[model samples]
Target: MGRWMKPEVYPLFAAVGVAVGVCCMQLVRNISTNPEVRVNKENRIAGILENFDEGEKYAEHGLRKYVRGRRPEIMPSLNKFFSDPE
Candidate 1:
């Protein structure tokens, strides 16, 4: 009754599904079975550590921001940005 895919192609679709499932299972095993990865996973801040540098990086950056001529570009038009007049 369907026009897009033939019934005979169902086996090919099932084979692709099984292949993808096997790849996913292997990926999970690779991550979960690693000693280093396991240690990282057990950490409380692992998720945050993935994207953020350790505190020392920020300490140096903050110390440098007070150099003589550096000005933070504080937003110029705060009222225009927040209020849309009707």
Candidate 2:
């Protein structure tokens, strides 16, 4: 194999990775600093008897019991990380 691909391929992949990382970091920072944004992820429109049809839906507790919405309750570390400041 004589130079399987252009030398630019590695750099392009690195650039894409950096871009994705930066975007993810910014998203995390935004979610952390804004409670309104976090609140938007909670459950508000569903009633107790409402039937869900195998799709994403929030419960009255703001998160679904069956593993949803980053599920901090299921992970102690995440729960601590997302704890409201005093």
CA RMSD per model (angstroms):
14.5, 14.6
Which residue segments of model 1 deviate by more than 4 Å? Answer: 36-86
> What is the C-alpha lDDT profile of model 2 across 12-76, one tens digit per residue?
87898999999997688556543234334243333232345422332233334545655446577
lDDT of 1 by residue, 35-62 (tens): 3344453564554444334344534454
Model 2 scores worst on lDDT over the 10 consecutive residues at 54-63
lDDT of each: 0.60, 0.55
All candidates: TM-score: 0.38, 0.36
Error of 1 at 31 (Å): 0.8
Best by lDDT: 1
